[model samples]
Target chain A: MKHSHKKWVTLVFALSIVLMLGACKKKVAPPPPPPPPPPAAPTASLTANPSTIQKGQSTTLTWETQNATDVSIDGIGSVQPNGSQSVSPADSTTYHLVAKGAGGNQEATARVTVTQPPPPPPPQPTASEEDLFNQNVKDIYFDYDKYDVRADQQAALQADAAFLKQHPNTKVTIEGHCDERGSTEYNLALGDNRANAVKNALVQDGIAADSIKTISYGKEKPFCTEHNEQCWQQNRRAHFVYQK
Target chain B: MKRLLSVVISVFVFSVILCAQQDWIRTGTGLGVEKVRVAVPDFKLNNATPQNTALQKTFDDTLFYDLEHAGIFDMVSKSFMPTQVPGMPSDVNLAQWSSPPPSAAMLAFGNLGATGNNLAVQGWLYDLKNTANPQVLGKQYTDAATPEGARSIAHKFADEIIFRLGGGISGIAETKIVFVSSRSGHKEIWQMDYDGANQHQLTHLGSYALSPRISPDGSRVAFSGMTKNGWEILMYSQDLGRLVHFPHFGGTNLSPAWSPDGTHLAFSSSRTGDPEIYVTDSDGTGLKRLTSFAGPDVAPVWNPKTGGQIAWAERSQVTHLPQICIMGADGTNQQHVTDEGFAVSPSWSPNGQFLAFSWMRRFGPGEPGAQDIYVMDITTHTWAQLTHGEGRNDFPSWSPDSRHLVFQSSRSGQEEIWTMLADGTQQQQLTTSGSNYEPNWSWK
Candidate 1:
């Protein structure tokens, strides 16, 4: 009976030792460990102060990064992880910042809207009217003691008529002038003839008769006082004065 | 019976001789044949009172100036006269005046006396050459004891002597000259003595008043004035001392001249859009258009002698230069008196034989010529330049006697009224204070 009891005890002890060995192997071969937490991806943020500005003005760009080894801006070279920079852009732009780490690269973008300034005011209507008239109209010069419009002055008369036709609402005064050589009375009559001749021509050219008035200054008012041909030629003219 | 017959024949013959002598004097003086050499010495102070001394000086100065301006006498200078002055016919030595030094054919002497505010002057004119019957004229005048009174006496005495010696034409010492003066800050009508004394403003229109024409009766002045409408003929009555209502012809009306009979007025008007000559009655009725040319006709003057013709400046359409033209009073027989050059401002002489005008012989730019006064004979159409190239001379008007001309000249650097003999001698400036122009002598 003592030999049978010792065999049972040995079998139970061997079963227990086998169970402990299985447990130790299980501990040694645990599932391949998680891959080191993905290296903690780098976090980046970018911002711009006073992004909208005039063409000649400037703005500052600010950026920040976490867990990054190198930081770079789209237009700027690599810089510190957290920094600020001054930049002037001629047009609307996007500022892109890149943060690089072991795991991956992160990018941040900032939009700066650029707008143009307003234009200046314009000049008065009356002043611009006079300016336009002076620019377009031309004087008709005459020969000494002559009332007829010469051939060379035909172009000036035609141009004047064209302008007058374009501005149908405008009225004009045609002043006939003469050089200081003839008697006051004679020159007065001559000036009258010159002014009337111009008026008749203008009427024939389709300009309204009532829109034009004539005056004879004779030699009383001369454009130039010098006693030379150049000056006399300037004095003997049919000058046009624009009226509202 | 024979003795009675001889007496009657002698009387008739004597009367005929007297009439012949009077006819010779008129013919000789009428032709302005020769200037009568006259000697005028300082008037004697009959009573050596202070009043007499002052009055005598005024009388002497006025008398001398009047005779010098008469244009019919050659006055002997005071330096050439003998020291012995004649107070009356009894104190005169005719031979001394007719001698070599004076060479005077006539002598005028006067004496002045003042009693309280009353003054008296006794004057005598002697024919020095006819010493046997030396007394030719004798006159006595009494007036107030003031300078004006003394001047009046002198003027009367001078006119008497001038009438006796200077043909039948009346002396102009008492006549006035109407002109345009800017002294009152505007071109206004002004009147002065023929010798430029007593200058005064006639119109206060406060605007431009030019080319004054006094009436023949010396009662009104016609001028061109700028009104709200335009330039119009304005009449100023000397009797009323203010402007009178005159008709306003539409457009510009200028240069008015009255007829010799004081019945009509001639002027230039632009009523028809072209300046033309127009004549209207003195009462602004019977308006008549005299010219109808395309060019301008201006400065119309009437013939003072017969009032039968009108002269004006017409701008020729062909030449474009003003030419002197004349026409009958009824607008007939329109003829051009000036053929060439720029002729303007025509003035008819009193005798109706000549038309004086301003002519620019050479006109146009760069042509160096001057405006001068020229007298043209109407019958022959011949012209004589009265003023040489001495500045610009224009607007000549004949004196009443037709022996002198008053014109505007720029010889003194400023336009001033100047008087000269009709033959262009004895040029004298009459205005000096301010610029004066367009002088018109009174008809009387």
Candidate 2:
């Protein structure tokens, strides 16, 4: 009986070895075809038509993609897989297309170089006479209770006279204003003297006498309305108004 | 005792004679005279119809105010008067009014009656102290029963009393004041009664019209108007109720003054390149330049009494300040009336004795001074400041009576027309709506 049991044991061991070898073979079978080759990475391309443009001009951007479920440009949000769009950018810009799919994300870029047009031509020199007078002519100021032209205002008078001489046909009305410190009657007379002083100066500087007229405001119409030295100084001036 | 009684009687008789011969109550110039205490009682409604009752109140109120504004009377308050109002001389109780409470020297009482639409007023003024010869004046008036009619009667009665007691100077109650008003959105010429009643626009020039001077006969008003051509002296005829033709003098022409005879007008013109005094006939003919100076000469006024002298504001050559100056009508005998300070707007008194003007005694920046009204004796050159340091007072015009003056003042926070006695007492504002200036009293 002992002999027969040993032989049976050897047979069981042999069968166990065979089963283990079979399991190893099953583990070594082909690795399931390598996952179907990952469906081919997404491809994208973007291009801008008429890439160079002047300011205020428009340009078209065309893009195409393959194997992409979602596609978008940098500035344009989510868009169809392939399309074209018109854009008017104030400055130069680059367009980038992003294609996202199950395989991977692919990015492509296009630069639209915007070239600026030339600047406009210079403006015409046909300014109005009044505008010219305002820009060139200046007001002269006087001291308190004084009608004579001050030393500081000599240059202003000279400039005014020079401008008037240049435009001999232009007529001007010189208005004399006074600070509200003296009596109305006295101020009227003082303003008159001031206007006459200016007129006399202009006439002596070779300007036509008839081209100038004078009036006295006598603190009636003030350029500034404050009880201060600065404001009063501004008010005490001989202003020029262009006449037709 | 008999001899003493005879001496007392003779002395009383002599005093009465002296009083009569000297005209004791007649104060010649209405200045420095003792104010007469006068009582004005409510006029009785003779025929108590609605119209009569209303007219009575109007007449009584008008009479009281007219006397009070005369500047020559001391008004007795109604509270001090006797309860039994006197409607006529027959009803007056001399002793009661002359007693301590009222102490009235004169009594003005009247009665008003309305028949249909007509009103009759019987007014009388009596010397309360002279019971024997109490009647001083009695007047009767008949007009349509209206407030204006009642006021007119009252004014007439008051003038009668003023004529007798105010040294023969006619009352100014009937005079009108012409001034410049900006109420209508433009500076236009306006006229009002002496007491600020009946305010009406005299010119609808639409442009600025200033410094109106009425003629002596009240027929024409001459003013500086901003016409299309420039500042021109324009005339408005009251008789025609429209603007009349006045030749335009070139440049700015302003402040026209009429001669006392109403035959000539003196104004300031800049036709010769400097504002100078110019004179022309009433018809704008006979134009003659009266002054030619380096500085401006403006605001001319004539001596109302003589019409031979003209006073104006002339700027000093050295100081550039305006000084009051007087010259003959023909532009001779020029004299400076003011020495220092800024002086302008000189108005000659009707009596030719004084010149009223506006002066800034110490005028300069940062100086503590104000424009005040001053009256100077023409003969002596002694001046008295009429307006105190109230706001700025200017443009003084004398009343026809020479006892009152109308001027423009800024004391009420705005420029307004005000009236006061010649001595600057009883300063009352006459205008309150808008800024009014350059009040000119009409010459009667």
Candidate 3:
């Protein structure tokens, strides 16, 4: 009887151990829900199609962003996460894109270069300096309320001067403009200065001083009507028109 | 017997016209003091002729507007006046005029008429407080019977009344304001009476023109227009009835300001590769540069009283802000007059003791500022801001008498010309339709 009782006790202890091990294996601690994913760092990428173009042409910028709540570009304003825009920068320009997300922020960049095209057909006698400019040179851009020739714009002005020299009879008028930021009276004066700055550059590059005339439309005339830095940069420019 | 009776009536009218006195009395002259309560009833038409009735209506309206704009008067509205209008001094009841509702302290009554090519006006002012000597002023005016002559007669009488009652300052009742209007589908120079009547287009160049500046003698209007050859300074001679030759010396020439003597013209020109303040003979010869800074300098106005200094907008090198700067007529003694923010369009007061300009205290993008009118006492460099967070207010031009200023404001959606007393009271809009800007008050 004592042996039978001892056997029953040993059997019960083994069964209990097996039950406990099975319960522990089935639970497996649930893995802590994978740590909630850490919110996700935003990513942004921007690309310019036909990044190089002739003076009068334009380029398109396309962008794609991931995990972002807001997106904006350096010169352009607020934009959708995945969108595209067309821009006509007078000179080579670097555009920056920023993406903001719940986790962190990310940035990307793209560039567009304005390239000179081949010369036009043989210049006709009646062709004015304005005609020549329209056919060959691109307009010069400026910073807000500025008239000094930036270092990056020196090459274009040099090219314009060379073209003027190539056609000695041409008489060009530089129409200066503002970005619609200052008083009209002051903008008129600032536009006058911008045109003169381009004229000075042309004169320095061997163009005749008398060949250049200046006019200031101030903030009246604009090439791009969008209210953004990218567009305002295009409006603040010195456009060349040849005399008829 | 009929002829004798008519002769007696004629003698009576002539005697009243001849015997009236212009004795002026002052009540007070303190700034912001209580405005003199004055009532202006419609002038009675003498003889009841159709021409005389029409002239009387026009004259009465003109006189009322001028007195109301004087800023020293609390004008009693016509609707609040008694049913009886006193057309002569004898018809006036002092107690009625001084009664409440209007509670007028003074009254202006008149009789006016127009005969064959002639207009005659007899005007009188009475002070209710002085029952014994209530006649504060009396005047008689005679001119051509044309509509213009009627308005002129009223203006002259109103000026006389204001000069007598307004602490020795001359009135601007006869002044004119020339401004740019786009009402004709294109921007053109238009001139109007100071109270916004008689608005007539002065230029038919059929293109955009701006900044009309009348000469001190009112002979010509110098403005910048977009001609076929581009923007050039053109002069429309009021005397010649055609455009006179002002040199178009190439490059953008704009903002022509006449010197006090009308012998020299100051303008902004970029003919020298940069915009510089250039002063030339009135016809645009003998060019000399007045500003030699790196940035542009523009909008030059002469100190009409001194005629020795010119004030202008010069872009500051340190702050990149446009500041009001004053220099000698010979381009010497250059000094900065503004401290911060964007400042432009400096117009010197007629007395040369003050300068009125447009200033933006927080001028920039994404964070814009309010452009307001400010008058600075040149002697102390202290300023008083005249406008607050409304629309942009700019281009203040002083009246010939220096008692009022006409300017451009965008408060009514589109830009329009407005006027106010020199102390910044009595603000009245002078233009309603289309965009009008850059008002230049005539020298008168």
**Best candidate, DockQ-wise?**
3
Model 3 interface CAPRI class: acceptable
Model 2 residue pairs with clashes = none
Worst lDDT run of 10 residues, candidate 1 chain A, spans: A181-190
Candidate 2's TM-score reads 0.77
What DockQ results for candidate 3?
Answer: 0.39
Which sequence of candidate numbers ranks them by lDDT, best first? 2, 3, 1
The CA lDDT of each predicted structure is 0.82, 0.84, 0.83
Which stretches in model 2 have alpha-carbon errors above 4 Å? A1-126, A181-186, A227-230, B1-32, B49-51
How many clashing pairs per prediction, in order?
0, 0, 3
lDDT of 3 by residue, A88-148 (tens): 8888999999999997899999989888778897866896556667888878888877788
Best-fitting candidate, measured by lDDT? 2
lDDT of 3 by residue, B1-444 (tens): 323422342343344334444211111112224568889989888789777777888888888888988777889999988888888887988898898766889889988877778898889999988999999888888999977898998889888888877756678888888999999988899999998989998998887788789999998999988887767889999888789887877767778999999999999876666678899999788998888888878889999988999999999997788999999999999999996888998899886767899999677765567888887767667676667757889999988766688999988888899998766766889999798989999887
Worst 10 residues of 2 chain A by lDDT: A181-190
RMSD per candidate (Å) reads 21.7, 12.2, 23.3
Ranking by TM-score: 2, 3, 1
* Fraction of native Cα-Cα interface contacts (under 8 Å, chains A and B) also present in model 1: 0.17
Clashing pairs in 1: none
Steric clash pairs (candidate 3): A129-A242, A130-A241, A130-A242
